[model samples]
Target: MSDTMSETNRMTETETERQEGYIPHAKQVDFSSFDEEMLRKTFPNSVATDVSLCAEGVLMTARSKSNDPQVTFNISDMYRAAGYKQTATGSCVPFAPEDVKTIVLKIKGSTSGLLEFFYATGSLTTATADCSVTGSYIGGEDWWYVMLDLSRQRNGQYTERFNNGCRIDWSTDVQKGDTFILGEMLFFSNRSEGKAYADSRNKIASTTIGKTGYGDDMPAEGVEAGYYVCLYQNKLGSDAAGVSATFGTTGLEDAISFCNSRKQLGYRVSDEKGNVVYAPYTLLQCDILREAKYVTTYARENHFTYGDAPINPAINNRAKKVSCDRLVCWVMYRVGFTDQPFTQGVVVSAMHTWSEENGFIEITDKNDLQPGDIILVKPNGSGTYALHTFLFAGAARQKGMYFRYDHGSDTRIMSHQPNVQELELPGAPFWRAYRPVATATNNIYYDRYYAD
Candidate 1:
């Protein structure tokens, strides 16, 4: 394929994240109607991931680029996750609507782990748990995504029902252009309490979602001053938590528990100093399906080739090439970070092969595979099955029982008939089961870099 077609096809699925006005969570509140503009002002410093609303509830994502083994955000006034637009109205046009039924929050990382997601409101000066969020270890790409249901309660007071020690502060009403902060504030002593891996959003402030934030007050040590956020979004936390109570709450919470209970630094959402507001982070009601498709399509469209692009390419000009996206997604699915978004490339490159020895399928002589192992299948290269990668979700010895797989070409993950197509493999086809492991390259810093 010519480079022009390759470039155009690749850009097809990519969407530019530009600045857009925030929309309120409430139906009656039209943040878009007002002629509001974001005012420039310095933010307070604290340590803890915070979450709030600007025109609406925003999603935040981030990563750790540093070599630090562990980090956290635990201060007041620090925005663990937040979004706001300073309005000339002088009145707060709340980001999150009082009647908002739910908020779905999603996050991810490179390792199979868990992260803590917190929701806090009111002045960062006074810290309270608006809501505590989490994403479980949904394998493969070390990603996590969950939904928070805030619509259940009309009152602002935090309720014990969801373990969120937060209640909408009667003192500060939600407002437009009102400052919504997330992830560490600088007010507390320990600033490195909350940190996220990678984040994205369709609503919330562009600054707060996937990165870290900062405030003026500096503590003796730990973390730095600035907006340390991960991702941002609009309307609803999104993901996992559809528009249901029983299903979302139970399923999401249960998933989180399963991932966190494990050993890896696993917990949904980064652990920050914010209050828990909702429960059972389900998939975002807005675009869960669309986003899933986008991720899969992006992977299929763009691929990396090591030694010059493949020659003669296979069918559809799909030469033998490695796909990190497919592998990571499958691994993540097996591990448990379900409903999460993964865009970054995988840790290892995929291998392409062309052979006629075996029919178009490269079958391994070994039968050792587990629930969370990586399953690779290459076409004998005769153009039979071409090339494919499967994430092992489950395996059964029962008759006609195929290994559970997540197809990199499609959006769904499932087990299917083994690839009949054959491809050349100098050695045995690689189908080794792998457990998610954390590596030094896995960690990334969201905000400013720390001197080593």
Candidate 2:
């Protein structure tokens, strides 16, 4: 948020940094220390007099007789397209059209006028734009974060014509003295690096899954092709209703029963004196448990049962029994990290080894874990290395503990058995965590089809 001249200066990446896939581009434009010579070198076509650096950001003032003021960013060097010359060279490598996913802009100005964006194809002087999107400002003085999803643009061929650069057109509603400020402009690539992967995972986790099913209502395009779990494939049978049934065992069902018995799991637990007591779970933990329950129920209901197949078939095969590792694979595939339930070994130990060999970095501290991180558990009361795998949902009800979406064991026919449980972190079984390297790929389950 700092508008300091030094902080708003353009970022330059070295050859090694560009080669390493660093997203090299302009961070902010400081008008206060405006350099007309550098602006000409960078944009070439932009009018230096149209904008000035303000205390907040780059402020643009409407010119007399021009109702629709605009700003142009000639970013030919940042994109690979035909018929365009790079105004500034050697700064960074141009990205392919498909590599770019979204364009985010932070702006604040007139609330009445529309802020329009246009992506020019071959030339900026063209009468028509290849693609365009319209957005509104937040009015007042608050910044509005507007996101334009390039993939959803009307012109599918826009990528081919991405050479001319892009323009922002303010609506004619502005008067001569009307003004607006451009805070930031960022172009996000489709490549599965840290930010891109985290954004995709967060979007999927928040919008795709519901309390009742695992993306049952999600569009086919929203899911990774070939690994799409159809609505019919996610059936929570009567076994889901058995959570309230008495079970002498101490696994998933028991956990759910205990949670139900004391509504105090996620809420604050108070003493008889009505004094403040410890809160076992956070509200986020409660929401995670609700969603995890549905995932567990669906896995138990639809996985390939014993003797149902020679081996566990692909998830698309609509088999009925899913092991803990396969369940993790399903979660990853749903999150667009893999194509199918991981093609790596089906056993927990082999998957754990594959994770280590691949770009999955090990995390010894549980506090470093994120919501979508993969959690590997050592066998309880034994020396077995990796006996189970699940996702680190989020923080648990208890302090210093986390929640996990676990498909407890391989297929079991018992109606009282819970395939998945939202368990506290490192309580019953010690856990080792692995954070996936989003950009890394391998011949096994880690493929670029989903990541890209």
Candidate 3:
């Protein structure tokens, strides 16, 4: 982006005088009702000429130049930075720096570019920002969320710079004529709250329902309740005694013992400091489902390419084309399973070989299948090998023998189908199942049979 300004390059004479005698205000700015006046005041030093308010939000057109374009939001008013607006008539409330942990930006209709965030004090023309973060955005017409973590500022000394305003700089990767809509802007006190807000708007479905052995159907014997039980016990500590008791287990140890007896098919346990202590299944199925939602949504919205060959020209597009194997590898990598690379020409056989090389064990019996397991479809004839592969979501609702799975294929490049759905195959024997390994390091799990 732009070079850091020096004190000599501060604001104009009039603006500098206002800054010198300025008194802090406890009033906040209402972003929902943001108008042209508010927009101009927020970015007094912006060089772009075409900044206006649209139905979606604020619209800004990048100027053609060598230096990167920038839009800085003046947060000298701590209340505004904290996401609280001053009423027409009410007591002025104050917020400390620690009260806000992240600044979230909702953006839409932008070209491929790098968005960088920085914190600055004093005039935008002169102040130097010591803290900076960069995030990438794909060129698309859909809305996406960006969150900047302020908690990591200056080794957790973010509170010391509470009054510093925030600046957003866009890299030249965003073309000159490209335009983007700046939607709702807000501040949250924690990462979970920010993520929740984005997840709500993004329409991410919950993975807790429709599972046989989890959620509301958790057994009284606590056999299939390992995920929730471990999560609660780790989060609650001694307070988890009641939860364990209610589940017919004495304590965390009892629940863990039951989980271990099932061949590490339960949830992974993490310590208070966020370190993984016991990882049953490489990662939680719920986490895998969450990442799947984002990946599928992104691919559909961005019109991801589709190809099968090693060096297909169609794959050269801005959003590279991917086969079913590439899609599966992408989802696994997103959730901390980085054993394989996202390469072209990755076929079902490659995945099978990779699983074998890793600790993933083969499961001949369908009853041993669990959520997040990889199932390779048996070849059509005796001459060929397994051709199609998918991620098992859960057992289907029907009694006979059907299962839900998340699938990705050349046909689903633009379609939203194969989004955690169930399909009736010829029979269960048509597919070969592979269970992930369980270890404290890998955090894999494999559970057998759904009990009533």
Candidate 4:
């Protein structure tokens, strides 16, 4: 992959974020949306990530790369970022038609990886033409706000209250993973809050869905800005009114009792912050389907060499030899579960696998071999002290059960059935599984240097 491709594709993954925009909760009038003073107070300026980015409940998808060449949209992972432009205008699903006056297009994001801003507006709608406005960032400033003067668009444009359509036009090709959001194109009343309360749409789309939970104004819940956040609530006021018991543990028992009294389950989003850490199932899927293909690649590169690279060039190409151990370790480390010593002891040991010390637990139970779990192998029962490790890609076609194995060779992680020796050896090859301990609530961040 190209450096640019890797950089762009690997970043900005919205893994299992709350979908759609905000809904007024519990029959409450949205006191959240700010008027002029509140708007300025709520957002003296706009921040892209802070705001939801949908328009009319759905942010417009990429049209073409450049009719508005100044813009770029990333729709899916691994696909090339393209220039998008508006191709046609179709719908006008306004949230509140009567309150459309000072429509604000508060854009806060970058282009070509450089911070840039774009905002535009045109005339109000009538039976004839539609309202329109367009402009690029005037300054080097990558962020800015544009409060559209809808009154001016209304003054001489249309005398009647015909709903100006909120339709957008796009001619460019959208790809597989492209997902347009709803909060992206929301417009607020000059007096009311946009469906999104914040200057940006993210507020409306995901309340408190920023880097932190809810919103930043929400105090750090005893978490030093980590994925694992714990709410240390206080019961200092001593409200015994609803409580029949006084089980204590930092308000948790009280909270639980309150729910139990009503026969409800009170809970939090994450136990820690495990849900957002790279998804465990997806990570496993990659290990099973994707990592299995690397064996051939590894073998070709190493030519089955046992140790590190820089294999002596003088050695005959066919004579070069490599061990499957290196291939297995390479696959494990690549998928972010590198905890074993690169030696035979860890490979075949009933205990002391490197993963035991890392952020993983050993799965000794025979029934726990799930696909994507890493497995240590002594190909045939006649396993030797020297064993090989591979991924538990999936199940096989045998009557009882056959595990489809995948591991790296000097060239690649084997994509096909490995060269399993049917020969049996005492204590030769033992099979065991390693499962990552991270989950939707528990995760390890100390070693996770890569951006989520």
Candidates in order, TM-scores: namely: 0.24, 0.34, 0.36, 0.28
TM-score of 1: 0.24
Query: Which one is best on lDDT?
Result: 3
lDDT of each: 0.27, 0.44, 0.48, 0.31
Point to the candidate with the largest TM-score.
3
User: In candidate 4, which residue ranges exceed 4 Å CA deviation?
Assistant: 1-282, 305-322, 338-351, 377-386, 397-431, 438-452
Give a tens-digit lDDT track for model 3, residues 1-452.
Answer: 01332322233222323543221221223344576666676666665435677877777777753235776665654233333343222211233455666656677645544466666544466535576655433346656665555655676664444355566675433336667676655566766676566565661111111112222223443132222223222111232211221111223453343233322122333222223345445445544544454455566777776655353212232445665666666656555445554345346767777777666778767677776777777564662457677666554323553333333554566654333234335542345766655444443222211111
Q: Can you give the lDDT of residue 208 in candidate 1?
A: 21
What order do candidates take by lDDT, descending? 3, 2, 4, 1
Tell me the tens digit of each residue's lDDT in model 1 across 316-370: 2244343334444423332222332333323223322211111123335435443
Instruction: Give the alpha carbon lDDT tens digit for every residue of 332-371 in model 2.
Output: 4433244333333255666666567656788877667765
Among all windows of ten consecutive residues in candidate 1, which has the lowest summed lDDT? 184-193
Using alpha carbons, what is the TM-score of model 4? 0.28
Better of 3 and 4 by lDDT: 3
Q: Judge candidate 4 against the unseen true structure and give its global Cα lDDT, from 0 to 1.
A: 0.31
**After best superposition, candidate 2 residue 223: deviation in angstroms?**
14
Error of 1 at 369 (Å): 3.3
Candidate 1: list runs displaced more than 4 Å: 1-270, 273-294, 297-372, 378-387, 394-452
